[model samples]
Target: MLAVIRYSVPESQSQDFIKQAHVILDTLAGEPGFQRGRLARSVDEPNLWALVSEWEGAGFYRRALSAARMAMYPLMILMVNEPSAFEDVYVSGQEE
Candidate 1:
């Protein structure tokens, strides 16, 4: 499943957020079902960031995300959305 997570960090906490962000990414990467992950920043909204990840399956994705949610609650506002439909396509220009 493809999971898309969007979150906002307060301006004052940006540095701290960046510092702690790796922990979450690393934890997810170590999970058995985790496939890939990416971090994104908005072109217009400076404080907004996004996390995009894929898992081996739906159940595995849910479990890993739930655990990460609990661990990251104290940091900032978090919003997650996983669309029920997705397709994995590899463009010639894209690298895995």
Candidate 2:
């Protein structure tokens, strides 16, 4: 499963946003079922950022959020309000 949270940040606030994002990523890393996570910005639109994470499953991801909610809340508040969770239906490089 994947969890992708998008954010619209002004260039002036990009540094601070990146810092807080790193903190949240670090906090979530300690939780169970966290495969890996990445913070990315859209190429054409730098203000458009995404916090992407892969998990063992939706349950694991939810549990991670539940466990780290407090620590991540501050940064999470900056995320765009929308559906962020996704199931892995296909992957190009991996064998089925």
Candidate 3:
């Protein structure tokens, strides 16, 4: 599995950004290699968000996302984590 993490400050035109973001997410969701995506925001830091996407190991998420959202994406830090262990929502767990 691969997880892509994007960090960005909220734009002055947030609604417009969000609208454009949905388009990208929707397109990716329908792609054959996409597994799932989770959009998370920090309660204490309103301007921060993490878009975590899981993809098939064979897919290149960066290229696909860049192609789909070049116009909509503002300058931001993007990190891709592959060959790293990630949480599986379907797994049974024992907590600390």
Candidate 4:
């Protein structure tokens, strides 16, 4: 499973955004079934950012996100209103 949260942040608050993103990722990392996470800024759009995390399954993703929602309520509000969870049906590196 994957959780991809996107944000539209002012460039003036870039540093602050990164710091907050780290806190979010760190918290998610401690949860069971967490695989990896990354914070990325769009090359085409300077104010666009994404917080991507991989999990073992949808259940894991939901639990971790719920935990994050409770713990980081302030930062969680910054996530753009959109669907964030996705099932990983395919991965390029894996053999068919």
Candidate 5:
């Protein structure tokens, strides 16, 4: 499962947001079933950021979200849109 969270941060707060995002990623890394995660920023629109995470399954992702430590991050309040989750269907050059 994949989780994609998009954010629109003001220029003044971009640095602070990045710092907090790293903290969230670090926290998730210690959780069970967390495959990997990364943070990306749009080249065309610097204030636009995305937090992408891959989990072993939907249940693992849900557990991570419900973790008590996750509740402390202010990043959730700054999201520009609702976070999205997707199940992988296919990958190019990969066999089933």
Candidate 6:
């Protein structure tokens, strides 16, 4: 499963936002079933960012979000525009 959180930050607060985002990523990295995660900034819109993470499944992802040690929620709630989860529907060459 893929989890993505999009953030809209002000130009002056980009640095601070990035810092907090890294902390969140670091914390999630240690959780069970956390496959990989990355932070990306929009090329056309500098203030836009997305925290993308891959998990083993939806259950694992949900558990991580509710974990006691997950301290990034507050910061996330402040920054995130819309967060969502998705299941893989297709892959390149998979239909061949």
- The most accurate candidate by lDDT is 2
Q: Which candidate has the top score in TM-score?
A: 2
TM-score ranking from best to worst?
2, 4, 5, 6, 1, 3
- Which ten-residue region of model 6 has the weakest summed lDDT? 68-77
The per-model lDDT (C-alpha) reads 0.71, 0.89, 0.58, 0.86, 0.83, 0.81
Report the lDDT tens digits of candidate 5 across residue range 5-90. 88888999999988988888887777899999999999999989998889999998888877825542587677876747899998
Residues 1-96, candidate 4: write the lDDT tens digits.
888889888888889889888888999999999999999999999888999999999899888888887555766656789998998778998998
Per-residue C-alpha lDDT of model 3 across residues 12-77, encoded as one tens digit per residue = 755655665566667667666788876666688766655667776544565556566654355333
Per-residue CA lDDT of model 1 for 1-96, tens digit only, reads 677667776688877776667777777887778988877778899888876788887787777867787556655454444353244565367678
The residue pairs in collision within model 5 are none
Off by over 4 Å in 3: 58-63, 66-96
Summarize candidate 6's per-residue lDDT along 1-96 as a digit string, tens digits: 999878887888888888888888888888899999999999998888888999999998888877724566656654665557898887577774
Worst 10 residues of 1 by lDDT: 78-87
Q: What TM-score, to 2 decimals, does candidate 4 have?
A: 0.90
Q: What are the clashing pairs of model 6?
A: none
**How many clashes in each candidate?**
0, 0, 0, 0, 0, 0
User: Which TM-score value belongs to model 1?
Assistant: 0.72
> What's the C-alpha lDDT at position 37 in model 6?
97
Native-vs-model 1 lDDT?
0.71
Which residue pairs show collisions in model 2?
A: none
Spell out the clash pairs found in candidate 3: none
